[model samples]
Target: MSASVRAVIFDVGETLLDDSTFWGSWADWLGVPRHTLAVLVGVVTTQGRDNAEALRLIKPGFDLVAERAARERAGHGESITDADLYPDARPTLGALRDAGFWVGIAGNQTERAGLLLRALELPVDAIATSDEWNVAKPDSRFFERLCTWSGHRADQIVYVGDHRDNDIIAAHSAGLHTAHIRRGPWGYQNADDPKLRATATWRINELTELPALLISSDTG
Candidate 1:
């Protein structure tokens, strides 16, 4: 870890947010069993395909945007609730801010998700989404926007997330430090891959470990 790091940005889904309800809600909308959708999500993940592919597998040529709109009209829209957060999420983020790090949340989530997160009033300096910025992760432009929003240079920021490709690899490639949190599906799966493990500056088991990692890195 670099002493130059001054900010910590987190991914939303599966990092701070549990996301089980997110998927289950989709299953309910599609009239499929939650377990069936869950299994399909796992299959897509193992294949390194987009998780949205699971929805497409259920209904070919699925227009995600249209479907989301239709769901809203039908009063079955995506929702975010307090229970969707990992228990450690708020405390860790608050701890980091208390320790004097500029903290933010940015992820490949929709504008609605962004608004919902802001509504929760998370102790963050900023909260942004791909939909809000019109760019998504693994896209260099997205990281550029993150750096800009963070008010710090890329190298001076440490991004934390669960995905190897979208979070660690992509953030590292953008010249930012990365912490891989091993909690969610992608987290558990990537933790087993030695090469992917090597890509992150640090690996942690939970969000609570982050403040200590940053503090020790500063002191060490």
Candidate 2:
């Protein structure tokens, strides 16, 4: 890790979790084809809209909280499990800690999602969610809370995530270094945007690349 960058914080959804099952389950609940929902997600997100708008487009005034309760009642509650983690998540996180870097997970997730992450017992030092803080990404307050929670200055943290707006641009605006990982839908779509790409301190395809990148960054 770079001496100047003392901590590495991550965004939860595409940064660590695959999130395919989350959306797939929602598609099943809505009785729509998975591909249909996937396509709509891409469309909405590409247009600078929230991914949840896809669900709203399918069903007007879709209340996520209400639907979540309905799913739980039907024994189909949303979940996050080991299977949702990308193969590189564990190894990379463990490596960062082993190398003596403070690590944390903070993102626009429900409080339930934060609890689920803690249940997994990853090697991170902290785990937080939007609901837990009463704030979400693209909102500067979210990153402000993250900086405080991590006990690191804005420049001392490298915020890694998949989304351009929420992860790269927002983190940068908050004065933290940003890593835009190229994976999930948002990852691939924004990867090609030169302006967005330039905003990131680093671009990587896998979490496994971070340690080496950060280590070598100081020398470069």
Candidate 3:
């Protein structure tokens, strides 16, 4: 990693949020019991596509249900204030920002997800959304936009995300330092994930583990 790493651009969905809880919140606000509501996401996400693919296919339905759920619970989108934040996300993000890093989100998400970030009160230097770009992760367009917006060169920014294909491979192709947030079943099971098997890079179990990687990335 370059010592010139002045900015850290992050992926949203699984990186900053569990995404499942967001789905669960939808069902809960709809008056479904929390446990039963889990099925709501299960039903939609179980179609065999990974979260990335499922997102593109199910986003419209996800948004419709989310609006319905929020309206049922609190009468408007403002009710997202009560949604769950992924465990440790607030702390990790806040810590990075506090550590003199330029913190921002370079993610593929529906417009509604931006609303969710505001509800959570997360601070970011910049936010890029796929709805606006029409290009999703694993495509370098998202990263390219981020560099243009942040005015940071690719070599000076680190992109952290979950999917091997979307996060690691794509960013690597763009010449940014890529880090994989190893959370999902697909990543762990797919040892041959393009990210893990890609040229030497750092992988971590969680966001808070980043500083060590920054220091040790070139130890070899």
Which residue runs does candidate 1 get wrong by more than 4 Å?
A: 218-220
Candidate 3 lDDT over 125-215, as tens digits, reads 7776787677777777777887887888988788887766677778888888877776754345443555366732667777888765664
Least accurate 10 contiguous residues by lDDT in model 2: 211-220
Q: In candidate 1, what are the lDDT values of residues 37-148, reduced to their tens digit?
A: 9999999999999999999999999999999999999998889988899999999989999999999999999999998999999998999999999999999999999988
Per-candidate TM-score against the hidden true structure: 0.96, 0.96, 0.72
Report the C-alpha lDDT of model 2 over 1-220, residue by residue, as the tens digit: 6868889999999889998999999999999999999999999988988889999999999999999989989999879999999999999999999988999999998888998999999999999999999999899999999889999999999999999989999999999999999999899988979878779999999999999888768721
Q: After superposition, how far is residue 47 of candidate 3 from its true place, in Å?
A: 9.2
Candidate 3, position 22, lDDT: 60
The per-residue C-alpha lDDT of model 3 at residue 47 equals 50
TM-score of 3: 0.72
lDDT of 3: 0.66
List the global CA lDDT of all models. Answer: 0.91, 0.92, 0.66
Residue pairs with backbone overlap in model 2: none
Off by over 4 Å in 2: none
By lDDT, who's the top model here? Answer: 2
User: What's the distance in Å from true for residue 56, model 1?
Assistant: 1.2
**Order of quality (lDDT):** 2, 1, 3
